[model samples]
Target chain A: METEGIYDVQAIRAQFPILSRKVKGKDLVYLDNAATAQKPLSVIDALVHYYSHYNANIHRGLHTLADEATAAYEASRVAVKEFVGASSPDEIIFTKGTTDSINLVAYSWGKSFLQEGDEIIISSLEHHANIVPWQMIAAEKKAILRVIPISDDGILDMEAFKSMLGPKTKFVSVVHVSNALGIINPVEEIIRLAHQHNAVVLIDGAQSSVHLDIDVQTLGCDFYAFSGHKIYGPTGVGVLYGRRDLLESMPPYQGGGEMIKEVRFEYTTYNELPFKFEAGTPNIADVIALKAGIDFIKSIGKHAIRKHEEQLLEYATAKLKDIAGLRIIGDVKNKVSVISFVIDGVHPQDLAILLDNQGIAVRTGHHCTQPLMHRLGIVGTTRASFAAYNTLDEVELLIQALNKSLKMLL
Target chain B: MNNHRTIKNIEQELIDDFSLFETWEEKYEYLIDLGKKLAPLDPAFKTEEYKIKGCQSSVWIHSFAKDGFVYFEGDSDAIIVRGLVGLMITVMNGQPAKEIVEAPLEFINTIGLSSHLAQTRSNGLRAMIKQMKMDAGAWQVNAENKTVE
Candidate 1:
């Protein structure tokens, strides 16, 4: 439990009640953390507390419940701002999830500023959520979409990315950590390079926000996006952190009750920063509960969590490497606790089914990175992503299950 | 009753075969074994033209009609899905076009496959069945045209 300095994974695992559940007569070994992490009891309690105690619409009435809900929701904004080291809470806009956040930028910023022959740069390591929005905007505006290729080992081609950046490059979006490959991209360097070309950078932090420590000012990124569920928070809530200046300059993403200052038959004025992007009533309960998740991470400390996950990744990598015919994808020097692999002559789906029967949950498919899979010349890979709660023993169980399943398949 | 007896007999055989396994694990192993024994499809027929949509995994199904009987050959990138395809082909292939179209495939439920498979896999299975039925209908029309000629 206490392997390293001040970190006890057993204590962390105890906070998450779902870790104790059994599936199919076997103890559940949840390894699908990248898809969405299991909620901690504290986060769940926060959700229940909100609905039971203060179930009212946010930013509306002068009633006590409404006031309580509004305060909690705004507190959550401050928590998120501190979590990612944003300059102010006003910079954090709550949306549905990471996909919704990216779509907001693509429509609001891209539609208003981008023009014909303008270029938007994204890496090959991006999930479809990060890719499709840019593609849609590019198609509409006739802006060219350029991709920074990745090496066979899943590291981005930095030289190619630098060459791709030019005066025409208006925007650059890259994944901070690949969901499928677990490769931690050098986003700071990417932002610096993109800035040299006078291009704004958006770091897709869907995978990194939970695993790594993020300081947006230090990174100097124009925008950062991540989902709450990827951390220990509830779904239907995410944060889109944009520079205050950029957000103010951009038009409103959606026109609704919360996003408008005033509306008339002749004209309409949008709300201030953050509210300009958040159109509707928003996922109030989930957003309020997200503070608990942020608090949960802060209490555990990001350094400790990162250390634990790094150990898991190293141990799993070594164990999986010993298996015959099993090839680990994306063996980069810097990565989170995610392992994607494929076995010769065994389809990833079949392997996933066998693992599920043994009560080990993993994701198998393109992982919404179909272009990445195509680039790697693989149909798909079975991905086992770990959270702070996952133990080395669980990794052992995974190894044993893979061995048994491989023997059966062979 | 004899008009569709072959399809019914094959479905019953599948149900009995699946019933041999006491646990889902053993059943899945059996399915994987069956998938390995699936008749290989022609490389040329593995194109996007023959690929079945609505499947999580890439699945290609090819069929042809000869002497009023429709034969199907199917393959999937996922082994478990391929096994499901093999099970379907075992029951419906080499049957009359009318029988292939009309057979309800009640054996999927009878064998407890419908309950066992995940929602996406179940949808994929239904898509395969629908595509096979469409292929049979098209082939039946072509056969009718030949008779007219």
Candidate 2:
């Protein structure tokens, strides 16, 4: 219980019961936060509460359970809207996850605005969710998909990005933080430059949402996308924050029960901003539970969490560098708490298994960013991403496990 | 002596050998050692053509038949996977192509590698097993055709 500087990490860790669990006869040192964070008891209870008390269809239901469910569901929307600093609750459109959120924008907006030969710019650091959706749309629209290259260190070549932005650049989709490398991209400069070309900008905040303070309004990007599961919330729920004007202008993402204003044999008009995109019954339990995740973040405050995580990151970076034959990719100053590294003579997959035996869960593979892996000139790197709950002691445990694992591997 | 052994005998031998190790660490160490000892595939066959799909690491498994018996030469960039490949080769190697194809590979369970390989993350090992069976099946088809001819 290192209760230093008003940031009680041990207290925070206590809230998540999974932290006390074990794997392979050892205490679970879960480091795979970048994949999906473990939910807090608060978030888990929200799901349980929803199912137990008021489990019913939302929006159109006239019954008491429906009213309670709808209230809780919409309350989450307002929470998300406030959480991301969107202009209004209408700006927050709930979807499956970041992938679904990005697809909503790419499918709806790209189909309407993209012309042949139009250039859509995406950085090299983007997750597959950010890249693939735009690529699909660009291909269908006969638009060119221009990629912003990265330096050997995995930092985005910002100057090259500036030169690429022009009247032809119809869209600029980039990640706030690289999930593969954890390098925070120069998205602020990117947004300003893309706006000069009148190109729409989308920030894939999937990796950044839980870590970075996200003020979508301050970001001035046309759209921001993130997943709830990454932020200690439930899976199958994500947010797409589009500017109200932009959201209203774009067509509905999916046409179904909730998305429709009226339906007749003649014609059917679509619903308003958020609901227009939220088609069908939506993930009722998860969406309501997502507010608890948001509240958990709000309770601790992002600044305190960020400060604590930075400590863990600094400690990890310094210690991981001490390991012989270990190379930290994208070891930049400005980054999140993720440490993606490759050790000589040891495959990342091998490290993943040996670490699991030691009860240390880490991510090993391309992390759904194969293009980035290709650029890095490696098969894959083992990543150990930290959450706010992660402590310096855990980082030391990681080092110890790595040393033990490497003994067998090397 | 090698020609006298059946696939069942080989599988039982593997289970017995693995039963000697009481701990997961010892089992993994054994697997890693076996992987290192497994015959390397020809560099030419190490290309995408022979590479096992769905593996986290690159695993190239080349199969051939000699005197109606199937032999497998496999290697993996990841030692654990290579070790799994080694285990597969141990069970099926030197068996008749028809027998190799028909072998249930129950030793994976008996040896306690089933739970370790079951994790979707280690899908490479599962994919490797499927590939071994498939390669042996191809040789079985060829042997059957030769009999028909």
Positional deviation of residue A386's Cα in model 1 after best superposition, in angstroms: 0.5
DockQ of 2: 0.78
Question: A348-397 in candidate 2: lDDT tens per residue?
Answer: 98898899899999999999899999998999899999998998888999
The candidate 2 chain B region of ten consecutive residues with least summed lDDT is: B116-125
Residue-level lDDT of model 2, residues B61-137, one tens digit each, is 89899988888888888898888888888888878877876777777778887776755456577677778888889
DockQ, computed on Cα atoms, for candidate 1: 0.61
C-alpha lDDT (0 to 100) for residue A129 of candidate 1 = 97
Top candidate (TM-score): 2
Q: What is the C-alpha RMSD of each candidate to the true structure, in Å?
A: 2.3, 1.9
> lDDT of each prediction vs. the true structure?
0.90, 0.90
Top DockQ prediction, candidate number: 2
Candidate 2 stretches with Cα past 4 Å from truth are: A1-5, B1-3, B119-121
Q: In angstroms, how far off is A181's CA in candidate 2?
A: 1.1
DockQ of each: 0.61, 0.78
For model 1, what is the error of residue A63's alpha carbon versus the real structure, in angstroms, after optimal superposition? 0.6
